[model samples]
Each structure stands twice: as structure tokens, then as C-alpha cells.
Target: MNHIPSLNDIKEVHERIKPFIHHTPVLSSASINELAGCEIYFKCENFQKIGAFKARGGMNAVLSLSKEEQEKGITTHSSGNHAQAIALAAKTVGTKAYIVMPSNAPIIKKNGVKALNGEIIECEPTLEARESTVQQVIDRTGATFIHPFNNYDVIAGQATATLELIEEVPNLQVVMAPVGGGGLLSGTALATHYLLPEAEIISGEPEGAADAILSFKSGKIEKAPYIKTIADGLMTNLGDKTLEIIRMYVKDIILVSDEEIIAAMRLIWERLKIVIEPSCAVPFAALLKQKERFAGKKVGIILTGGNVDLGKLPF
Candidate 1:
């Protein structure tokens, strides 16, 4: 479990989480294909439990815990989706969840965590503050801290998304996702490496909070030059574990702007008739940005989540 997940590891994670999560549908739009000039299959994690792919990793991480660890309960720091995932997972396992969330996290996400009965501790909107807050919570409650993206168990769990993707739509020529702290991207890269060895794994990153792309090139975990993006879920920098896997397996990380993200978000709403947050639209935006590169190829895009603040609509 400490090493990078093998094909068997991902399959086991899928089976472990199957009862707790949705086998979210793989959707396609003919018009989207015409626009991107590629045959695109969208893994709609928006319809997933907790309305994001974070559920997969959260459930797997919590479920993998020993009975002693489960009794101590689990804690994590997340902007929104991961918080909800941890809360729901903890609830399912009959344990408490301590969620350290940023003060600036969208109200919708905060409410989702509350609805799941997570104890919320608000902190300043920075990684430093988040770590400090989570540490304090662990100190006070003796809870086991679950890192949002940096842990192997979480990465293995995230890999199940791509595992299911290739199982349903085999032999995709290109697979894409949005890079945040690189959990989903690294997981996607690893799963594609195991199952579809010939498929090129690409990821979209926010141009504003653009650290993963820099890390991908530099071969180390690097910080963003500045942090500003509509993709709140993607603002964090990459972790060391995630960086190592990403550098080894991922092919490219494409950068997309807020404008392009919004445009892509709107396109999915109009064409696919599905609600997706700005971050979920990133990989599709990346595909649109470089249509010629993926032209006429079979592409699978991981629509990571749908947790947008309805009141603060970017469109």
C-alpha cells in the first residue's frame, strides 16, 4: 500500500468503494466531439457521491484504516469537496470527522460538510493555516489526519476513476484531467499507464494557480507564482509523492485561463446538459485549446466535480 498502486491495487480499491459510491456514468456529446474534433468520453464524477471524485479517495483512505485508527476518527483540510467526502466517509464507518476548511471556501461546500455532520474549523485561506489548523485538531482530538492529495491511499482511491473509465471505454488514445495537488492527475496517469499503456495522459491546470505544470517541468514540488483562479479545487501546489508519480507517468500539463474555463463550463451545461464547476471544465478546456493535437482521436476526460457556488455563478 505504500508503493504506487498496481493494476490490482486500483481494482481492489474500486471493489472496496463500489458499495459506497456511484458508478457514475460515462457521457458523450456529439456536438462536443465536433467542436474539439475528437471523440470524447466524459467520466461524470459530478454525479458521484458528494458530487465530486474526492469521494473515491476519501472512502478508500478511511476504509483502509485499521479499527484502532477508525475509532480515533479522521481529520482533513479541504476547500470543500474533500471535506464533504471525509465527513460522509467517516459517517459511513461510524466515526467522527474533523474538517479544517478555509474561511473563503464557497458557502455551498461548507454547507455540504455541515450537512454530513463534519466538525468544521475555519482557518485563513492558505496552506500554512490549513496545516496548522489540522494539526491542532489532531492534537486536541487524537484524530488521524488524512491529507487531501499527498497520501498513497488517497492516490490509489483516485485511480479507481480512471480504472473504471478504461474498463468502460477501452483503449482511449488520450486521457485528460485537471491537476490540483496532483492526486487525480497522478492517479489518472498511473491507472492509464497500467491499463492503457499506449494512451497519452494529459492534464489541464489553471494558468493563474499554475504550479503543477512548473513542478512537472522542474521535477520537484514548486509553488505557484500567484494564486488566482475560478478553479478553487485546483489552487493547491503539488505534493512530493504526487510529483514523483506525475513526473514519471504524465505526458503533459496544459494551462487554461478562467475565460476558457468558464466557456468550457458553459459548453457542457448547454451541450451535455450537466452542471460542472470551473475546475471540472479544465480538461475539456485544455482539449479545446489544442484541438488539432487530439483531432480525430478517442479521448477520455475526467470531469472531476460539480460543486460550484450557485449564487456566485461565473457565467
Candidate 2:
């Protein structure tokens, strides 16, 4: 697997997706700064197209394809954001998208996919079931697979967010993002290491889905037996390439509980006026829960996505 993505690769992706995607703003709060005791600069990826950072990777992957490949279309399995990103990107490129999603996926995300005119294949929630269903779709349609997190182009595209973040805030001392399959974390680590060499790259994971944390500690890829948390987007085993990047650049992994995540969500909603999902709240939760470690430091946090269903607020 290709684990390394050079600065040039990230630079190319920055150019490819710039016209289509927003350079989502970075936000800060003196109030939240008072609570967390750190100078936090939040990269508002939650405000991005498709309401997630996945748009960068998805758009880059779709746009990189040749005209012939576009004619054949694309396929992938995702819980939400990736599906919407690919669906929207394919539509922009005048191509078709076949997305396999778990039956349990949020209704808002499924609707977002349909809104982009992407065909949906509903399957059971297990990884095996999702992969099997996607395989059948691929075998029948011959659409190129756009992996959610594991592909080289996908990782490179995701890295562009950190590229912009670091460029905008060059003095950042520490950078952090929530890790699921490690796509965002991998890309962030690669870009930060290359662009801001002295910055510490960290990842926040839900206590229920802390595979990346365990993997970092044990020096091996790990997976939780079952994930039980409101942060649906952060529930997955770390991919092989992602693990390699984590080993190379990520300084540490921190765990946040569901309660802490809810508190963080409320803090963002009340203070930042951002409607981020539980997955996006993990990093803030880590900072709030572990205040001593980050006190007075210049911290960068990726508010990864804001695709939560308004009606389903767990408050």
C-alpha cells in the first residue's frame, strides 16, 4: 500500500479541488479558549461542501479519473459524508455514482446522496456486509471504486485541508483531528509534518472506538470488537496505509467518552454556533477533558464535518 504522499501530491490536489471546494474558514473563541485553557484555532471543515472534509478527497478522486473512467462511473461504501461527497463530485463531473451505505446510516446522509442523483445500495452495518454489497455493485457496473479513506489519491486530497490550515496559521504548535479509518488524521499528519515540521500532530478518538489509539500504543493495527457511541463517523478499524502515516507523524491519540463528546457538542453549538456532529466533537472533547496538557499552546483542530440530523439531537 502507498502510505506516503509528498508535498507535490498535496499541492496538485489543492489546485484540482480549489475551484470546486471552499477553503473553509478557521474560527476561534475567547470563551472556549477560557474553558479549554488553550489558544484553539478551529478549521471549520464542518462548513465545507457536503458539510464535511470528505469533499476534498472525494472531489479529487473523481476529478483525477480519465474521461473513459468517468464514463464508466464510480462506486464506494460510506456511512455518510464520503457518499455525499462522491455523489456531488460525480454529478459535477457529469458522471454516475453507485453508493453502498449501511441500512442504519443517518437518513439525512442518504437523502444527500439521492439529492446528488447517486444510486444507493443498502446493506447490513457490518464491514463484511458493506464490502460484499459494494463488490456486487462493482462486478455488475464496472464503476471504479473510490475508497472512503485508504486510497493514495484520497489521502492526498484530504491532506489539502491541513495544507490550508497550516498556511493560514503558520505558528500552530499542535494540530489534532478525529480519527476513524485515519483518512483525515493521515492526511493532516503528512501535511503538517511536511509543512510545519515542529508541530505536534495528534488524533482524538471516541472511547468506544479507540482503535487508532490502541494501534498507536501497541505498534500494530487494531480494531474494537464493537463500537457503541454517538460518533458514528469515527467507528472503524485503522487502514494499513493510515497506520503507517500515524506511526510516522501522529504524536499521540486521546480518548473521549460519549458524555464528554456531548458536552463538547453543546459547547460548540452554544459558543461557536456550529452544528457539528458527534464525530467532529471528539477533538474539542479531548481538549476540554485534558486541559492541562494543552494549556497556553497554539492548537489547531479540524471540525471534520457537520452532517448531523437536526431532529436527532442527543441532547
Candidate 3:
């Protein structure tokens, strides 16, 4: 099992990555407020560099390496955003990056990796295959492997977004984020529990990739035999460290269906004039689908990323 990042670790990550990351703006909507009966604040991480919040963690992990380790380069397996984040971060730090991605990864993400001058290794869409391919690249190039959401440094880095959000919206009563490998949720839980102890830290999971939901309910880790969702970003299973943090600090994990995700995506696009991927829309889907439960509260939802293939818009 991997080491879990604590609040102090997150604070260090924030300090290290602060100069490299954007404290993305938070947007509010009276329209959404009326619907959910809550004052809704959306942290627009979609506006972040690399079109996602992954850049913070990517930069932190890459920059933290020793000069010799950095000279060997960095490697990771990602569907899209994380690959681009690592690629761009490596470029910023004067190093190289090798990304392992599934053959079925979105073209926008694949191209983004290439655009950043990162080498790409295409593999089958299974977890085992992704890991094996990443290891092969690491062994061949001697590149440092940066696990997408499992590493303590990576999770701590991802938590910085929540830290900024809470600081900006001090009155927030509840916070929600999309969960996949649970890195962001774990980091967010740690930060929110420390800063806003009264805040309810909730996780939004795609019904297609609701392993976290099942894990929370079963009081143990669980896996979906196969991921089936348009929300490609949320298809990953929870990591051991992430599950431990979620069990300790997360208030609940809510599941949203593909249809609900689509509806929320469309709604955000039409109303907020913001483009969010299916994974980023899951939290909104939960707010809309579970209105009775989330109503009459001050909710902060992290809009995790916006790297969508415009040509593949399901709407």
C-alpha cells in the first residue's frame, strides 16, 4: 500500500506548486441556487492550465524530484488530463515525460501529450495493461513513475485546489468533488477536515464507475470488473491510501448515472457557458439528482476539468 498524505503534506504541496498553479476562480449561480435550494459555488478548475487541476499535482511531483531523478525523466499512465499535465509539467521543469495511455483514450488528450513533446505508449484499456506498459517504459528509460492519483505527493498536490476553494468561500458548509482513484477526494477530505471542520466533504461518483460508492458501503475496497462510462476520467478504481482517507474524512459518496451526468454537462454548458467533461459534471449531477438531500445548504463543487474532445460532445 502507498503512503497516505496528511494535511501537512498537502500544505507542503501547496507551497511547492503555488507559483506554478492557478488559483482558479469560483463561480456562483442564482439559477442553480434556486434549483438545488443551496448557494452553489463552482470552483472552475476547468480554467486551469492543461485544462484541468491535474497540473498542480503533476508539477509538484515532477519538481520535487532530485536533479538526478529529474534528468532520468518522469512517466505515468493516464486517460488524458494527467498525461497532459505531466507532459507540460516536465516541459516546465526542463525534463522529459513518457505517458502510457489506453488506445481508446480521447484524441484531444493524446494530441495534447504529443503537443507537449511527451512520448506516448499506447496500450489496452485494462488496469493491468496500463501498469505493465508504464513499468516497461520506466525500465527502458529509467524514468521516475508518477502514479496518477495514488501517490502521497500527487494526492497532496491535488488537494491544493480544495484548499484554495475553501479559502475563497469561507462560508461554505458542504464541499463536493468527483471521485475516481480518490486522490482528489482524499486530499480534499484532509484539507477540509482541518480547515473547515464543520464542512461535509462528499464525493460524487459515476454510477458506471461507482466502485468508491460500493467500497464505502461495503466497508472495504471494491472494484468494477469493467468500467463503462462516458466519464472516462472517473473510470479508475480507488487506491488503498485514498480509501483510507475517504473512510476517515469523507461524509458520503453519491452515485450519478450516465444520463444524469449528460444532463448536468448540458446544463452547465447552456447556463454557465462553461464546457465541462462528463467526469467534471458528476458533482452537479448529484446536486440535481439528490436535491432533497443537498437542498438549503451552502455547497462548493469543484469542477475538476474541462479537457473535452469537442467533436465527441454527446449533447
Candidate 4:
């Protein structure tokens, strides 16, 4: 628990946060399977609390805090889903949440945090600004910082999604997720390593915000060459903790174009009748991009979130 999370750490976190989080379902589409040339199982975290899998990690992180820490409240920097997640989690634990968000974050996500009673402090849309803003909030309010994807507790909580998936649909040949700061991908890798050791753990990353694939290849955290992705939730680069776990366990990180991501997103909406954000579509897009490699395989893909801005949907 102190270092990288073990399988027991993830299981324990799941039990601790279960009351506050939904056991999101595993869904599949025969049409999608036919198209992808693989039997695909989707972990539908779009239906999760706060409408994203971030609910699991955010709840676990807040609930894991000590009484003294809880009294001081919690704070974090996030683009959207994680911000709402921390807000909802703080509310559940009867404490205040101070969220530091970029000025350009979606209005829907901003409203979501407000609905949960989280105090929002907007800053310039950059990582340095976000960190400095969070530090300022911490200094003024004495709130503990809960990183969205970097901390071990958050990673353990994220791992529970994959654990649940494998539990529901065992014997998957490959398991995949989209990489942003690598929280969910690292967690997915860990869960697959522990439970389904034989299963290959892969990830899809936006070619626009394409740092993870480079980091995976270089064995160190790297920034994207340029950032201009419709997948707003995936613009951030990998953190040290997440990068370490991802490098240790993940098999591959595939790159997908915005066009491909949109196509995949539309297919999910049409075939599965589920709404997924662009980042959520990246993994499926990767699968479709390289269908021949995984032909006739059983694959499990974690649909990370469904928090897209309705008016700004690409397709």
C-alpha cells in the first residue's frame, strides 16, 4: 500500500469504496464484435456515479483520508471527470472539496462540480498553473491534496474497474484502456497482471495528445509533441507513479487519430446505444485500426467515461 499497489490493495480499496460507488456493468455489442473481428466486452463506467469510472478512485482517495485530514477538506486539479468525482466524493464523506480547474474546462463538468457543492477555483489552462493554484488553495484552506492519477490510493481504486471486469467476464485474451495521465491504464495493467496473468494489457492514446506511447517506448515520462485532441480529458501527460506501473506491466500503447476516435465513438452510440466521450473511444478505435492482429480474440475494453459536452460532440 505504501509503494505500488498490490492485488490485495485494489481488492481492499474496492470493498472500502463499494458503498459509495456503483458496481458498473459489463456490456457488449455483437455488431461491434463483428466489426472489430473480436469478441469485445465493455466495462460500462459511463453509468457510474458522476457518470465516470473516476468515481471509484475519487471516492477511495477521499474515504481513505484520516479524520484530521477530512476536517481540513480535500483539493485536486482536474480537467473534468476527476473534478466532479472529487466533488461528489468529498460530499459523500461530509467534507468540503476545493477544485482547481483550467478556465477552458467544459461548462457541463463545471456545473457538475457545482452541483456536488465543490468550490471551484479556475486558473490558466496549463499544468504549472494548475499545480500552483492547487498549492495556493492548500495553503489557504489547509486541505489535503489528492492527485487525480498520481497517488497510489487513486491507482488502487482505478484498478478495481478492471478487477470487476475480469470477475464478470473471465478468460479475456486481451484487456485495454485509453491512456491519459496513465492512471486507468496502469490500473488496468496491474489488475490484468494479477488476475489474468496471461492476458495482454494494451492501451490506445490520442495521436493529438500522444505522450503515453512515446513514454512507453522511452521508459520515461514524456510530453505530447502537440496538444489538439477532441479528447479533452486525455490532454495531460503521464505522472511518475503512473508511468512506473505502466512501463512495468503494459504490453503496448497504440496511437489513434481524431477521425478514428470519432468513428469509434459514433459506432458505440449507434450499436451499443451508449454515450462515450472521445477519449473513451480511443481504445476501441485502436482495436478497429489493427483488427487483423486481434482477429478472433476475446478482448475486454474499459470504456473510461461519458462526460462529453453535448453541444460540442464531434459526431
Best by lDDT: 1
Error of 2 at 107 (Å): 2.8
Q: Would you estimate the TM-scores of all the predictions? A: 0.97, 0.96, 0.94, 0.97
Model 2 misplaced regions, further than 4 Å: 1-3
Clashes of each: 0, 0, 0, 0
lDDT by residue (tens digit), candidate 2, 51-155? 999999999999999999888889999877899999989998999999999999878778899999999999999889999998998789889999899887889
Q: What is each predicted model's overall lDDT from 0 to 1?
A: 0.92, 0.90, 0.86, 0.91
Error of 2 at 31 (Å): 1.1
Count of backbone collisions within predicted model 4: 0
TM-score of 4: 0.97
Q: Per-residue lDDT of 1-315 in model 1, one digit per residue for the tens?
A: 688888888889999999999999999999988888889999999999999999999999999999999999899988778899999999999999999988988777788888998888999998899999999988888899998899888999999999989999977999999999899998999999998899999999999999999999999889999999999889888999999999999999999999999999999999999999899999999999999999999999999988777888986
Off by over 4 Å in 1: none
Candidates ranked, most accurate by TM-score first: 4, 1, 2, 3
| Cα lDDT, model 3, residue 272 | 86
Candidates sorted by lDDT, best first: 1, 4, 2, 3
The window of 10 residues in a row where model 3 has the poorest summed lDDT is 1-10
- For residue 97, model 1's alpha carbon misses the true position, in angstroms, by 0.3
Worst 10 residues of 4 by lDDT: 306-315
